[model samples]
Target: MAEETADDYLKVIVFQLKEEEYAMEVDYIQSIERMQPITRIPGVESFIVGVMNLRGVITPVIDLRKRFNIESMEYNEATRILVLNKDNSEIGFIVDGANDVMDIPASKIEPTPEVVGGVAEEYLRGVVKLEDRLFTLLHIDKVLNKNNEEKRTVV
Candidate 1:
């Protein structure tokens, strides 16, 4: 039998955005929540939808659609907020939906192609294939750092 290192497989949380599926490693995720009321903030990037209280901790939320330059869609029952811890604070990303947690063998992960629709290349960590479905693995740091926007003061 072969040895299994921590890098042998990637455990990820799969989510949907538009018609494509995306994945983010579970290690970075804090929680996944159903759609909730968001209090809009003034003078922030258009992609930064607003902020919402997550169990009494005010967390800033950003619409991944807008962040990826994809057209906006109305929030429905399927929408979700993926909360993550960043710099001792919490931030959330609004996604179309999050529906899977799976382990994709590292062998199945490929370097991102030159052109993948919906999200920009910099935001992608790689492409993963599990059976017949493909998942775009997102580089969460790059996704949130694109604009180098100042971190908002969480109340």
Candidate 2:
């Protein structure tokens, strides 16, 4: 008979970038979409891949590869856009591919070490180990705030 803490479990959306696995809490993810045409907007950081029109809304897309300084790869059939909601704004994160949603128990989650997957320490919420796999839980807010250049009027 063990007490259940609020941190006992977390549902995460796992994705791959530069061959490394990463996770973001499912609560923040609005939706997952296939690769879409992106309209490039200049004067922004390289990580900012520009924006795309989703239905009638304009959403900004970010390349996690570029954001984490990881090696870039061509977008193909496996590419995916993870729509995330922060506050009242919605943004898209372009990942190499999204695997699946997983429930990670708190016991398996550990605070981030020195570095995980070359991504900035500040951008990592923590790390977890499950089934011989190391999953880096990302802090999407910090990732998106890295440049904050994407915060603009979307029409």
Candidate 3:
């Protein structure tokens, strides 16, 4: 066993999902964009909302609520799409609304519990406790890699 160092402090972009707080590593995020018109594509997973032209790039967007089997809600003014880079492929995840960036030290993040919220436990890195708030840390790779392939994809 080794002592956690300064590198253990995880910088995360926190957001709201079904009224609960969730977070993902800032390193994997590209940018947070406002909800934009998504061109629907048929024959894909239900969670796959559609693709959008981000600047000159075509990016696929997924509704995190639908992906996690959480109750769907109307996209409001605060709704946002989190741009993510994995390997060379870029994707987007629509969340309830993005909040703030917070750094949670390793000791503050607890291991995934049997049932955290709507998302499957396996897709979670852990949960963070800060004062009266709790933010579930999302494992972006696991959430996007449906096949669980070992191949590393760099964004």
Candidate 4:
């Protein structure tokens, strides 16, 4: 008989923030591209950089660093925007740089620990231990929910 293996898997899109690595489900990501000009929206949340014309569609961009309360860094060669879709709404997330796509098996993923720095427990989905390194998986829905709630309260 063949040994049964856990099929727990996630299609993740990895990216960099500061010197750490993070990832989110690919299904939530619509597109990825280099940083472009943005139109600032007055009175909007500071985390919200502005809106961008994405192939004729105006999409709001969020600076993930600010959203997470991390110190902001200037855009560089590795900077890119990760377009995400949630609840039928498209939102763009600015990331430091994008890495390769990785399929993480279920066994490799574990519940996030409490000691991870610069990351809130609510925003984390899980921790994937790959080789000797750890990758933080983000819960996009939770993050977006918090953003939407803040927007509503402000309006």
lDDT of 4 by residue, 1-155 (tens): 55435356778999998888999989889999899999999998788999999999899999999888789989998999999887788899999999979888866778999787987778898888898877899988777765444333554
Collision pairs in model 2: none
What stretches of model 4 exceed 4 Å from their correct place? 1-7, 147-155
lDDT string, candidate 3, 79-112, tens digits: 9999999998889999999999988887899989
As for candidate 1, its clashing pairs are: none
TM-score of 3: 0.89
lDDT per residue (tens digit) for residues 93-125 in model 2: 999899989988888889999845478788888
Screening candidate 4 with a backbone cut-off below 3 angstroms (N, C-alpha, C), the clashing residue pairs are 8-106
RMSD after CA superposition, every candidate = 5.5, 5.6, 6.2, 3.7
Q: What is the model-wide C-alpha lDDT for candidate 3?
A: 0.90
Candidate 4 contains a number of clashing pairs equal to 1
How accurate locally is residue 79 in candidate 1, as Cα lDDT from 0 to 100? 97
Q: In terms of TM-score, how similar is model 2 to the real structure?
A: 0.89
Q: Candidate 3, after superposition: displacement of residue 50 in Å? A: 0.5
TM-score, one value per model: 0.90, 0.89, 0.89, 0.88
